[model samples]
Target: PAGAGQDQTFRADDEPEHGDLIVTEAGVLKVLHTPGHASNHLCFLLVDQQLLFSGDHIMQGSTVVINPPDGDMKAYIESLYELLAESVRYIAPAHGFLMGHPEAVIDFLITHRLSREHKVARALGALTPVDLKALTAKAYDDVPAAIHGLAARSALAHLLKLEAEHRAFREGDLWHAIHES
Candidate 1:
């Protein structure tokens, strides 16, 4: 990751609209503002062929990691649904080979994420005022300890999402579930 950093920051002055067209020899690429994996992520959809160029928004065999402070669970789910509303025949993801059945995969990922969010909520409810590590252990108990660090990041992301929705709160290093009337 040393050389991955860019020395300069570029300003975008001509960002296309959601349905803006970028015609090329291959086909017309329709710009889609699919921000979820990151706050500024975008995907291009080929109009004629109905092909999608999903860069980190959708992975081949794995779900996108929605880490908090950068990744957003709600926005990711919304973006998936937005893609589902489109007419996508094939998905050209950044990390995987060409894949079909885009709709099914998107649906599965959405369901999986929602399920994980529920798990995080349940864990927080059962262990209020608990630190992230303890919550991660309870929430991701089925996961291997080797990947607990990554798992904790995801768990923290879910907690941040919950906080955004006003369903939970954090005090110091501990997170707590909010019980509203």
Candidate 2:
């Protein structure tokens, strides 16, 4: 995504936040603040057609790369579930064609992410205090080596999520699994 230029500054009043109902001639475009793909990612819902303009939140037949800091596994999954609860018939992604099964897609994405998270946990449970690269190699062996660099970052995101839940701990760059007695 390209950064807005200096001239494209937006005022607070004009800014659309989460759950803001915006009325237009076409229809009401409900603003849903779906962060995690990026910190400020959003998806607009067309009230009339029940169409969702999913801007990079969910993609067509591809998993979103959950990079750390800006991209969060937890937040991304939450956003997916939130969108699942909504009445979306069609999904118009930023890339690719429109998707008819929005709910199934959203649910599948959630399941996929959770499954990856589980694999990360299992990998951690197998080893004691491991670096992100080793965990990624073990957990995401299904992924190609060329993209392991990217997968490492996504693994780090999972570790961070595990740490947030107190299921794991970080000691410097090495992460340790935290097993509750």
Candidate 3:
């Protein structure tokens, strides 16, 4: 009732912008729309507890995949900045251990995503301009074979941002490098 999924379910409404803070019976929580992992992704900051419920926003063991249309790397970076300013003490991720140092975890997730952007660039260089599938393989070789599909989604995220920036092109399931002008 008080502290429930209302803050999460209605996150996409343009009415509540990104920085709206919601107070509940449990604690004071802020609604941070941290896209990139997903279009409707949200992270809640438990203000009094100093604990951040990262949701799918981040995890301990695995990198959060970014899918296009719903995900934006730029927005994710902005969300990180918002969280950093909050002075979070601990992070309770949706799929990981409670993080002792919240800033470090946020920094690590942001850095890893930036590295993925670089990897996508390198993968493009190694190939004669490949499609999303091949690029996903090269960029995410560290991930399990079964989850490469998940990696493909993450690759698509970077590609979408790159395409928006005019650095990549996507035709059907394929993606090709576009020389920046």
The list of candidate 1 runs beyond 4 A from truth reads 1-4, 10-14
Error of 3 at 33 (Å): 1.9
Scored by CA lDDT, what does every candidate get?
A: 0.88, 0.89, 0.77
Residue 62 in candidate 3, Cα distance off native in Å = 2.1
Give all candidate RMSDs, comma-separated. Answer: 2.2, 2.4, 5.2
TM-score for candidate 1, please give it: 0.91
Off by over 4 Å in 2: 1-13
Candidate 1 lDDT over 4-55, as tens digits, reads: 5764566677888788999999999999988777887899999899999999
- In order of appearance, the predictions have TM-scores of 0.91, 0.92, 0.77
In the range 32-130, model 2's lDDT, one tens digit per residue, is 999888888889999889999998998887878788788888888889989988899999998888999887888888888889999999999897689
lDDT at 131, model 2: 89
Question: On a 0 to 100 scale, what is the lDDT of residue 178 in model 1?
Answer: 93
What value does the lDDT take at residue 97 in candidate 3? Answer: 93
